[model samples]
Target: MKKLDLTKQEKEIVEHALDHWQASNLLDVDKVEELKQSIEEKGFEWKTLARYAFWVALVSLIFSVLSLFADDAMVRFVEKFYETPNIVFCLFFAGVAVGFYVLGFRNKEKYPEKTFSNETLMLAGSFATAACIGFLGQVLDRTTSHYTLLFLLSIAIYAVLSVKLHSKLIWVFTLVALGIWFATETAYHSNWGFKFWGMNYPLRFTLFGILLTTFAVWGQKRIHVLQPFQSTSYVVGLLYTMIALWCLSIFGNYSSFDAWTQVRQYHILYWGILAIALSLGLALYGMRTKDNVSRDIGFVFFILNLYTRFVEYLWDNINRTIFFLLLAVSFWFVGRWAEKVWSKGQSSER
Candidate 1:
């Protein structure tokens, strides 16, 4: 019905065979032989590339795991290789990153046919190396500013890697880096709970919450399902908002902390416990009704209740051992109920 377009070489091969044989309508054996040869050549090329990718991945995984245990030794190794001998630890990590790329380039030149695959794997290895170095800097308490920079860099790097590798698992590491940065910054401040808006963690969460809602709303209009950017932004934004709200109500109002007040400890305890119970009940109702805005608002009051309760037993009446025991028992009961509810949810999902 339809005619096939053959390349000049294919047409010549068919023509040559037709001249030698009494077969003009049948398939050409020469054409099939040429195809087989081409396939074998391409297959060999693909196998070579695959070997490079596999070895690179295996090496990266080994180095990453080893860095976790013999961290100091690895750091020194990088430092020596990089020649930044002062901070053997930091330099060593930096060197490893440099070396991975340098080796990738050298290997690419050596095996030109397998260049693309090896280069891709090398790039991934470089990211893992950088993330490790950044994490170590944070653990060593090099500086909050430095830690913040490292985590931000790691997040960006991993996000790009997700796109390049076409891997969803990379997103988990990106979220982890984001969470780490937020928590680290939150903890860096010397003040505890409910400081000024500029210095407060809740305010940060509130800002992130606003950002999430804005994007989620925009994304819902622009795209049907949640894109990677949308999902990441929304999840992180809600987490920050919730944490900030909790911090605000718990640490902001000093009057709620009866231990700081000159009131009788037992009177403070009774009032505080009553306040907490009412607020928690409201939060539960809000959650059940799917009133997110109301639930967020109620979370503030719930935090206030927790702070008051803590003050009553831990601070306000630290001398009252019986009250402390009662408080612990109450918390234990709540925890048990929570676990049961969570287990039921998991079972239903299964």
Candidate 2:
């Protein structure tokens, strides 16, 4: 059996448990000795130290660039590089992205256990890809705000790479690109107006999120390659939907902030009701269905709604001490509930 490297305290707990098991006749002496030999007491966590070292290296690299400019000769050299054409930058970043992707793939094959490093490399590649796309867009045109086309290109590139590599990080970037595309497309279509089809930005994003979530739920089984990412897509979609709903509760369908402020709080009571009701409903449904993501997000939504309402209606009328006391007590209850839920989950796993 592969040995485990555990801290001194962890090793002690394991040994104690093994001893208890032997006393209870659940494990024989030989089994207890075997279990004890299967673990080593570790004094230091080198993995964590390695990660910290990499972080310091990144910071040092940034400082090195800043320090380079402090030298007169180096500043001239950097200025000459800055004057390079956009197409050259596009090609350079494209090559850098390819290098990172190649290195990431090599690490995945050679040291599959180095999951964090592999993902970091892939993330770097994704960023380089974005930079490449931006520069390519600039190379295509010097004066045009049709950057939505750039986002479209980004979405396509990231989506293709994500599918090819089965990388969730790249998939997340694809979703981000999609969101940007949606925003820019709508804004451009509306001539950068506050109201698009008489619906505000929050309302439009809410609709987009609803569509995305519906598609995720509907296509999970049909799209084999995307099956693993279904939950991610669903949760992200629901997050977008829920955040937009929260904003709708606060701002309503008003075209401008000034107009919303001019209206009474009670005028948008229905929107708040809808948000809270959906949050509570989703929370209860998730608990019944054993969907942890939905349950946690729903609870957060419910808590945020409650706190926001209290701030809006009762902040001025209630005593400061009583208000804070109520918040503390409510949070305590929530913590206890969360503890019980986690305890139950652990017990089930054991």
Candidate 3:
């Protein structure tokens, strides 16, 4: 078999994972050693370089498209193009989207090793699809900011494509489209004041995240096909929930920044406490369930909540020297704790 070339961190992770599997009797020692020997750790990260290069190539392609319209004659033609019917642009982009999706599918079958190129095509297709949707919306000539409807259309299109392709990248876009629809629909109902039922952006997304995560965890068994997306959904959902919780800890559910400043910062102590407790609970739950997504998010945010509070309550009253000293000591303690945990894991594996 061809040896796998991996970065140092990737190699460590693979080794640790193999060790865990062996410990659990999922793999014999011989297989574990064979797997380890098959993988080589590289000092240079060519995969990272290739990823960035592909992104640059995609961007260059986009710019090439734009540059077609950069010349004065082409600019005049584009102006005239805009004067044409919205359906024309819609149909044009629809064709482009179809072409890209077809090519992406073809590459998956014909050149499966070209992971980045295949994804780039699908990503471009998604962009074209969005253009098609936007133009289709404009073709209707509505007066209201019915943008939510457009995002809903995106959610549907991306969701269908995601399932059709069984592509995690497309599924991520679908999730993003859903989030856009949620936020836009909420703003639409709230007259664009950026609030819903007195809930600010962070508060609304926190609930949205919770719902997404809960459904992912609970519905994985119900929908076997969606099982492939479970980890991504969980991570994205927890990312939303934890980031929103961080904001809530600082802002205390106030719709306006001015209102938040009207009261003492310490007055929102409960919010901070709530955020910390939830993070801790999630971390513990993750450990119990062997869910790394929950564990990482929870532990990260638990530390975040502590640091944020440290700055919030102490920055003003404490001397600068003392604050820096305390911060340094806290970080050192965290580092030591992490080191201890890592050594413990390593020792147990050995």
Candidate 4:
């Protein structure tokens, strides 16, 4: 029989199962060794190190690029281009972005394994496209906060490009642009007020997140074209919801910090209750649907919400040492429980 391809963790689980089988006399020692030899274990540690190194290198590259802006000659050289029409720069960058996108696409097709390199080029193209759109927006209107319209335009462009190129990276940009547009639009409508429709920004975003998550779920079921976006949309939605809940937990519906400061934490019990209820509800739904991501998100945020409440309500009243000790104990129990659950899962899989 052909051996199944497995990750390092899976290989470890299999080896443990093999040892159990061997002890039970289900397989001979030689056969166990043969099975072990058949399994290929990739160096997970090396992969992890390489991933971190790539991020560090990318950060360094960004700083290096930024450093060029610090040079007087380079700054002046860029300023000299101010005399040129913004539309000219927009058109030029738009063409360059298109060229880069084409190259990245071709590279992705030819060398699928070189994901980092292809993605780097594609990322540059995305940034260039943003610059193009930004300059175009400025050319059309040099004054006022109408840049929100340009953000909407960018979202549209990115949505189209993501579909055409089958690029999740571009889709991520689309989501980001959409978020910016929402914020800008809300700000424009609210005139930078602390409350809109009796809710603060975080509370409002919580509603937006819930709506987006609902739409994503519905779209996944009804729209074939949206299937590829399901995971990304779900993640983004959860992030928005969790972050907004966290903020709401801290600040409630107050628009200003001064108002929040005057109000006691207990006064915000309703917000906390709502947040907890929603998180737990999502977790319950995830468990029923067998959706691990949703379940994990829900559980993690549930714990976070509880911890946040503890800090808010107990930090001042509790003894410092005893409080920390209790926290330590709580985490220890959580760790033990998680280990037990993980072990059971591994055994069941075996």
Candidate 5:
């Protein structure tokens, strides 16, 4: 038997087969075809793809500018006739979506790499630009329909990009949109105190559950990407704790503390002092014993204390810039403590 070398395409196919084998042991005939298609699509030059992206962006800009100035007389007239501009707007979106998908299939051969196509580029730009425009529109006028349209477009675009590019970023964005939607919907129907903090709390808890689940999934993905989950876990866990504490503070009455507040806000100062001392003590013990978990726990408690001041604004409804000054002083103390402990530990080790 004679040894033979394979051609370039054959080598590529063999390499792909090995990669796919690692991905899955169960081989289907369709898998080979899918792999071939994926390789052929992804082989296009990034520069060429970027050029297509540029053109798509230009087109989107032109459409947006035209929409801005074009005698919205037609839109206005339709609005009067239908009496449902939002429904019309949503329907327009549906039509555009269907048209885009149809165009995608019709031109599949031209853009072998679906991700690098002009259509995909335009879709991505539209989503990104719309989100910004929508947010700006909301800032300018709270009642503007554009903001809702922007959220709708953003959610749709993220869903499409997640599937098309198989990118985790798009998936994360989609998850974020869902979280926002869930929270808004929950707040709409729930009672203020319970939703804010009491016993009959179904909707608010549901919203919180969704947010927690999203964070858990995001954290798991981050752990894989980061090689160490420690930093992310510390930060996210602290944020969750801070949020929970804020919710509790919102519902909690300050009558007991109010008794002390009569003496020039002395009660808050007392609580603040206790919180600072406790965080400092924990941090010191953590550093002395080389306990990373305890150090993180200290950070969490310290953040809650710091954040409590902000939450107090909602409770007592104070608008004092003095609070910012207090925050600055507190952070300075935390920094000084960290620096001292870190330097002392390094000196001892040396």
Candidate 6:
């Protein structure tokens, strides 16, 4: 029989188990050696290198595109193209988007392992789709900002494409479009004011995150088709909430830096408290439900919230030396606590 392929970590685990069995006289030394040889241990270094290379290539591609705006010749060429009717421009980019999307879909099916390249093509298609929508909005030329309408269109396009292609990458763009739509719609109505229902943008987004998270949880239970999106929605929702909480903790509801500075940091401590509470709640829920993603996010943001509070409350009031000493001591305790917890978990597993 063919032996199962194993990663380095999995090989180590199996080896440890075999050693335990041998020590207990369940297996002889020769059998242990044979078992070890049967399990192939593959290194993950190449995967790490590939991941970094992919990011470098992606960043380089973005820079190359941006550099086009700096070239006078390219600028002039684009200007001349702009002279064409807006509808024509829209159709041209929309067609390009469709071509790229189809190519990406085919590549995804045929060469599933070429993940980075396939995603790059899909991302290019998404950008083209955005350009098409932008030009289409300009062609329509409503008196209002019309940005909300464009965002809505983007959401619809991305959502539909995501569902059709079963592409989580496009689904992520759909979530982003939803966020942009919410922010822009609120801002347009407020005429770029700081307060919407006595809440700043960060505060409003915090509420928006809560709404999204809640809906994700409910939808996952009630809607069969949305099962694939549950993880994505939950993750994005947590991201939005955590980022907004961080911003809210620092700025509160005040629009201007001056206004914020006028108030004592303790006055805005409630926001920090709320952020910590939410993170802890999520962590507890994750523990209960055995959801690692939620637990990890919760723990990470819990630490972030603590650090943010420390900076806000202590940066100016305490001596630099004292602050560093306190920080070091806190980290030491946290590390020790984490070690104990990890050891306990390992023991339990054994």
Where in model 2 is the C-alpha error above 4 Å? 3-78, 336-350
Error of 5 at 35 (Å): 40
Candidate 4 minimal-lDDT segment of 10 residues: 42-51
Residue-wise C-alpha lDDT for candidate 2, range 227-320, written one tens digit per residue: 8788878988898889999999889999998999899777998888888998888898899998888888888999898788777777787999
lDDT of each: 0.57, 0.87, 0.89, 0.84, 0.52, 0.87
TM-score of each: 0.40, 0.80, 0.85, 0.85, 0.37, 0.89
Candidate whose TM-score is highest? 6
Score candidate 4 by TM-score against the native: 0.85
Residues 129-175, candidate 5, lDDT per residue (tens digit)? 34453444444556533234445556686667545644443455555
Pairs clashing in candidate 3?
A: none
- The alpha-carbon lDDT assigned to residue 186 of candidate 6 equals 89
lDDT of 3 by residue, 88-112 (tens): 9999999999999999999998988
Error of 6 at 193 (Å): 1.9
Ranking by TM-score: 6, 4, 3, 2, 1, 5
How far residue 325's Cα lies from its native spot in candidate 3, in Å, is 1.9
Over all chains combined, what TM-score does candidate 1 have?
0.40
Runs of candidate 5 with Cα error greater than 4 angstroms are: 1-88, 91-160, 163-168, 184-241, 250-301, 304-332, 344-350
Number of backbone-clashing residue pairs for each candidate, in the order shown: 3, 0, 0, 0, 1, 0
Clashing pairs in 2: none
lDDT of 1 by residue, 299-334 (tens): 566665675657645765456787678678877976
Candidate 2 global TM-score: 0.80
Point out the higher-scoring one by TM-score: 5 or 6.
6
Give the alpha carbon lDDT tens digit for every residue of 270-343 in model 6: 98999899888887787679798888889888888988898888989999999999999989987997799779
